[model samples]
Target: MSTRTDEVERYEHLWQEPAYPHRWVLWDTAGDVLVFDRETNCLVDFDDESVLPDVLGRMRAAGVPESGDYPGRPCA
Candidate 1:
């Protein structure tokens, strides 16, 4: 998402899952770009296959900034 060369920081947008606003849970967005669950605070390799291209494709079309890396399952 934001890792794309076409994307920029500062103006870089932060993305989140709104349905769980009170949960403080971050979106595990690696599944949308890389197949594996990326660990918390880790940098993601955008070309990884763990991502779901279909979802990214749709969101990219809507101009939504891709989410930042997040914690995987069992986040404490």
Candidate 2:
């Protein structure tokens, strides 16, 4: 049986691949951006504009396209 750590490792490996599936971006009411990884049920919140470039870089590394704007449902 796989432990939780093993599952997490698997997800991490998957995330390193190009065009990893089920990854999405969401905007909060406050206008911050959040990266949602469906496979891992993880949310990476970007609360500062200064970190946007870094965030975008990470997104690209994860095979998600970079866009000036992302259309999606707002987070409550």
Candidate 3:
């Protein structure tokens, strides 16, 4: 499979299961953004701000609670 396809598959697998007892947040590092999976401490690269709405939409559709405004904090 192509690299892009592989990447997409990886991304899906990353979020395939919810991280219970641990919340997630979009960590903005100024240079880029990422989905910080608190339970696993997994940091998935998120390069665009435009995709936030769509991502959050999908999360809500999947029954995940909606998030508030961007924290705008640097990735620790």
Candidate 4:
């Protein structure tokens, strides 16, 4: 597992529920992405970084950074 990687998938079923609950399966592998179905709760491993470009593009288009943390931010 690489420390430079991050993965997140929103639980579809919980996404529509009244409570804002999220079931997250995080990965720290440089070339692995997971796609899990909320209904079945099965793990599907996709050892490819190709899909991340599209995902990052979407996030960039939405005016959000591909990543949230700013570890380099200087303390004020």
Among these predictions, the greatest lDDT belongs to: 3
Q: In lDDT terms, how accurate is model 4?
A: 0.34
What are the lDDT scores of the predictions, listed in order?
0.36, 0.48, 0.50, 0.34
TM-score of each: 0.25, 0.34, 0.39, 0.27
lDDT, residue 16, candidate 4: 34
Better of 2 and 4 by lDDT: 2
User: What is the per-residue lDDT of model 1 for residues 12-31, given as tens digits with 9 covering 90 to 100?
Assistant: 22223333221222244545
Q: Which window of 10 residues has the lowest lDDT sum in candidate 3?
A: 64-73
Off by over 4 Å in 3: 1-15, 18-36, 40-45, 67-76
TM-score-best of 3 and 4: 3
User: If both were scored by TM-score, which would come out higher, candidate 1 or candidate 4?
Assistant: 4
Stretches of candidate 1 above 4 Å error?
A: 1-51, 71-74
Residues 1-76, candidate 3: write the lDDT tens digits. 4554443444453344665542565555665445666555666455554555556444445554324445334458
lDDT rank order: 3, 2, 1, 4
lDDT of model 4 at position 29: 40
* Residue-wise C-alpha lDDT for candidate 4, range 22-75, written one tens digit per residue: 232222245543333223455434455554544434333444312222212243
Query: Candidate 3, clashing residue pairs?
Result: none
